[model samples]
Target: MDEAGLIERTKNPATRESLRRDLEGMGIGAGDVVLVHCSLRSLGWVSGGPVAVIQALLDAVGIAGTIAMPAHSAGLTDPANWGQPPVPPAWIEIIRSSMPAYEPATTPTSNMGAVAEIFRTWPKARRSAHPATSMTAWGRQEDEITARHDLGDPLGPTSPSGALYRSNAKILLIGVGFNRCTALHLAEHIRWPDRPSVREGAPILVDGERQWVEFEVPQIMDDDEFLPVGDAALASGVAISGNVALAPCIIAGMPQLVDFAVDHWRAAKHPATPR
Candidate 1:
């Protein structure tokens, strides 16, 4: 929104203090590990933009808590399978050969959003090394949460998202909804342990050299398909809604949301299938 319109709705510029207060009011407090999926535009003019929003999250969680966000880097993916905007057939090999190795500290995130894109670059932030589905984290368990990420199980139990669930993290969706929620992927992993796989490749440093490695990963479906599950979750009152600096926010426990989604998906996919 324009500056005047944003100020009108927010009553003032969004400041670190204001954002912090809003987050606390929305039930985020000290010692709460949170996985955030946010849209900077939906946040309605944060005073310092994504920077202030990140700070507010840190402040809300305090010194004892941790915060995490998806730091996926699509550019690191195998170029041979680029369908959305596939490259020329002849350029596939060139792109694959020239792509840089995924570096936890230097590689840029694909398109996680302005907030996450910036948060991943925080000086002290730690990131997993999954190349395709890496996650960046801060605070208490930053290392523990993003320590180990296997390419084959990008969203499974060993992935950062899974670690968050095991840690009983809270999911905070800012100006977004279930479509942007990463926690639900954990449900997919649990719900379909033997789900079909897709070929994926990325450049990684192995033996001190950039090698294009390929593997098969559970084919994580589109987010649009998750709408029904999220709608049901909202109807069941699992997702609590509140405001944060003129933006709508959804908060729910990571495990609860994942469990709720898995049950809903199981029932929907197989009506007569026993739980």
Candidate 2:
């Protein structure tokens, strides 16, 4: 939104300390492994924008805690599926063949927002190696959280999502919803009766040459059905609700969400659901 629109809607200016105070009050504490999805626009006018938000999150979790965010660089993926101003049909192949190799230090997050884009570049941050759907982390557990990102199952049991689940992590959504949760993708990967996979490719450096690599990942059609589960979680109080700075927030155990969602999905007999 434009500056004027932002000011008109978000009248308060939140600070790092204020944000930290709010987050801690909501139950995040020292040594927690938390995945965050925030919207700066929703936070109103922050004193330092994303920088302040990051500082608050780090402070809320303490030195021993870990913080993560989706760092997906989707532009590196197959241009054939592109939308939101997709490339011309004639230029798809040419662009895909020449796109720059995914570099952890240089690539930017597409559609995740300013907070994530800035957090991934923090001095102590470490990002997963997945070219198209990487996750970035900062803090004591950064290394473990970002390690071994499987190229094929970007959001499955082998990627950062799995790592977080195995470690009993938490997810904190600030002015966002389950549709962007990502942890739900892990639940989808463990289909009871098995599921199909989708083929995709991304540019990566191999043997000192940048090449487009093709692979099939578990087919995760959509999150259109995520609302019911999310609503249940919130209404049942399993997913805690509160405020971070000025924006509404939701916090929940990653495993609990996945388990709940898995049961809901399987019982629904909607084979097309989840991962």
Candidate 1 Cα misplacement greater than 4 A, ranges:
1-10, 269-275
108-170: candidate 2 lDDT, tens digit per residue: 899999999999899979999999899999988888889898788798888999889987889
C-alpha-based local distance difference test score of model 1: 0.86
lDDT of 1 by residue, 104-202 (tens): 878988789888889998979999999988999999999999989998989899899889999999999988988888888888888878778888999
Q: Please name the candidate that would achieve the greatest lDDT relative to the true structure.
A: 1
Pairs with steric clashes in candidate 2:
188-275
Candidate 1 versus the native: TM-score? 0.94
Model 2 scores a C-alpha lDDT of: 0.85
**What is residue 204's positional error in candidate 1, in angstroms?**
0.7
